[model samples]
Target: MLIKTIFAGFGGQGVLSMGYVLAYAAMVEGLQVTYLPSYGAEVRGGTANCTVAISNEEIASPIASAPDNVVVMNNPSLEKFQHQILTGGVMFINTNLVESRPVRGDIVLYEIPCNDLAHDLGSDQSANMVMLGGFIEKTGLVKMESVRSAIGDVFKEKKKAKEMNLKALDVGFDYMRNNGGKA
Candidate 1:
């Protein structure tokens, strides 16, 4: 039941926050979890990524060399981590922003219109949540209920963001359920 996942995007796209939320949700489920984040020198638009490992057993490290699942929010991230996904892994792409597809055929690919969906929900910044929703639906790594509960704890200070983020997450999950994954 070990799952190594990576979330990648620009710094302002909430990449790290998604990882944090995932780690927190895993904790709530009583799973062993580790989260590590890295960002480029430039803050807002710089490259940002986070690796999270969740398992029923002890986690040896936070680094994920070959992640079982990768969520890419932008084209650069798609290019950066596309080849790093393990065989039989799943890659969730924010199709609204990433125009390209993965070159590898062994891994599963799930295309999500994250930015557009978030905009439909009235907040483009919630794109990360949309991706998270799709990832959860596709992998069942964490229950949406756990994520919902974790959201309150994660964004307790930002009341408005909490509501929008929850909605965006629902949108992503529903989209994935309604539309099957593309390998």
Candidate 2:
């Protein structure tokens, strides 16, 4: 099986972190994975994105011209990458920050209020984790336990951060499972 995903948002939204964690989780599952990150010169507020490809067999390239999944964390990202998704692919939009919706009808769409959900969880910084959780739940690409462990590994020095991120992940996973396409 192979799945290529793009996570895009402003630099500070943890877009690269989302891709890294997903790639790490896939690696932990013994899957072949590649993560490529790109950002504008002025990070933080600038545009940032990452592409992650996970496959059971060898992958020919890390770049995905047409991704299977696109997770957009901001309106700019939504506008920029919405049309790059392959037909029948899935797109997860952060409704809290994105005002415009995709016009495509062939792709599956999931609207998630990631910032709101993370704020309710105590920190908006965990919004990326929230989106990741929902995507994982929808795709079942890697086990949730693997993601938890990957989060622990990523934030090994900060216990509270790890806990909060894990909670945020669980919240997103549950939100997707319960709400499906609705936010």
Candidate 3:
């Protein structure tokens, strides 16, 4: 199975980090993966995004013209990438920061209040993990153990932040399982 996903948000929102962790996890799971990151001139509070391609077979291209899934963390990202999702694709929106909803009917939409959920978990910075959790659960592309392992490896430099991020991932995963990932 091939899953091409794009994660977008302003800088410092862990947008690239999420993609990094996912790509790492996919690699650890023995899958072929590719990651491409983009950002605006400004580092923080500027547009940032990454495209990840995960597949069981060899991938010929790294670019994703029409992503199979999308995770939009802010309003601008929602506006920018909402229309680029393929028909019957899955889109996860962070409701805490993104007020706009997807207009497409063919795709599945999951409105996850990532920031709020992360805040509730006592760390607003981990909002991306919450969204990542939902995406992981919804897509079932990567296993939880692999994600958790990647998180530990990804955040190895910042030991104090790892626990909360793992909790945030669990919160996102549980939220999707309980709430149902549907519009």
Quick one: best lDDT, which candidate?
2
For candidate 2, the 10 contiguous residues with the lowest summed lDDT are 174-183
Q: Compute each candidate's TM-score over C-alphas.
A: 0.97, 0.97, 0.97
lDDT of 1: 0.91
- Compose the digit string of candidate 3's lDDT tens values, residues 1-183: 888999999999999999999999999899999999999999799999999999999998998899999999999998899889999998999888988888778888988899989999989899999999999998988999999999999889988788888999999999999998576
- Per-candidate local distance difference test: 0.91, 0.93, 0.92
RMSD of each: 1.0, 1.0, 1.0
After superposition, candidate 2 runs with Cα above 4 Å error: none
Kindly give the stretch of ten consecutive residues in candidate 3 with the minimal lDDT sum: 99-108
- Report the lDDT tens digits of candidate 1 across residue range 9-100: 99899999999999999999999999999999997999999999999999888899999999998999999998899999999888888899
- Prediction-by-prediction clash tally: 0, 0, 0
**Model 3, runs deviating above 4 Å:** none
